[model samples]
Target: MDVSWVDGERRRVTRICDALRIRIEGVARAMTSDQSARTLSAESADVPDGAYSGDIEAVLITEEQIQQRIAELAESVAARYADAEDDLVLVGVLKGAIMFMTDFARALPIPSQMEFMAVSSYGSSTSTSGVVRILKDLDRDIAGRDVLIVEDIIDSGLTLSWLMKNLATRHPRSLQVCTLLRKPEAVRNIVEVADVGFDIPNDFVVGYGLDYAERYRDLPYIGRLRPAVYER
Candidate 1:
């Protein structure tokens, strides 16, 4: 006779416990999301003094953005040379292209050999002198190899143009250009790049292997230089 009431009581208790469990899980998930967000914000803000924060006008491309684009470039370039007989050759223009080259080579799925050429078109100035001089040449001959020119920035395109011509003499089987940044002037230089990570404005930029008077290259992200830093 009282069995119906006992069954009702048990069902009520089960429903209450289930609701509590769902509520607790929701609260826990929310707390975890908040903690993760705070951690990311702190990491983004913790730039070291070597980044030259004081001299940076604004961040042009963020660290995350650069790395993402480089990954994409690596995939595309690797696919292009997937059928190559030998390991693809990565011709890095030294000093500036060092950072991009290392990161890109590591990201590529296909094997690549790194060859550096230190060409100087700008000494301590913001403007390129339009004259290219090779400070260092490739260690091994690139003849009949698939060579990809990895560049940090193509500002006036003078250096890249000269580089293309110079590398042509080596008679590489296939040669192409992949640059992380390209300015408006570079578009008119007639040196077509196979892939460009970002086409930026004509503002003077530094960091991520690009520099001004050999400073600010240690920055993890690319940033526009404060006018005062270069003007002085």
Candidate 2:
């Protein structure tokens, strides 16, 4: 398990991080009067106020909220696993979840084990092709161990569903999922995600680890891809 394959993947991902489409304009500016997101109470249905491109049909979650939720999740995890040892294993879905794994590993409750796997139901295009494969396998030994699968986003749920079944054969003591984003609307695969950070609408999102044609991942914040550029 050289595991050096991750470095090249991250570099390739980094190069595609900056093409997010957020055009600054007078109308959109007027609507987004404030440059910063005003703190909203959890119960407040406060509308989003970031740079918008279209009907916002393309926008899903923002990086700010994701970080906030991640911290909260870490706190919750700390409280839950306080009495346990540092045997938590964090497995990240490749190509899309690499960025999330870095930030999430730092916020885990204890010193956890880390592993990466590349599985996808997506084609070269943005749409789901409904086929999943284990391109890369986990390097860590999960037999009789607690493993938490960290996913960037879960939609259609095909990949994770297949992964759950596949990993079950490994004899892990327990297996649970902690996804950064989950689109409940598109969930068809039969698997239970134990911990979820954010529940976003069913939209095609990019940035903060999501991509469109392999672009707009390092934008710091997630936003909808412009139809002209990605959705067509």
Question: Would you estimate the TM-scores of all the predictions?
Answer: 0.78, 0.71
Please identify model 1 stretches exceeding 4 Å from their true place. 1-51
lDDT of 2 by residue, 1-232 (tens): 4467888887556433311111112124323321222222234222255544342343345667778878777676556566665568888888788888888888876878789999878875767787887789998778767777888888877777678767766666556677777775434333456666666666567778777766767656656565667645
Candidate lDDT scores, in order, read 0.78, 0.65
Clash pairs for candidate 2: 17-218, 58-224
Best prediction by TM-score: 1
In candidate 1, position 43 carries an lDDT of 22
User: Whole-model lDDT, candidate 1?
Assistant: 0.78
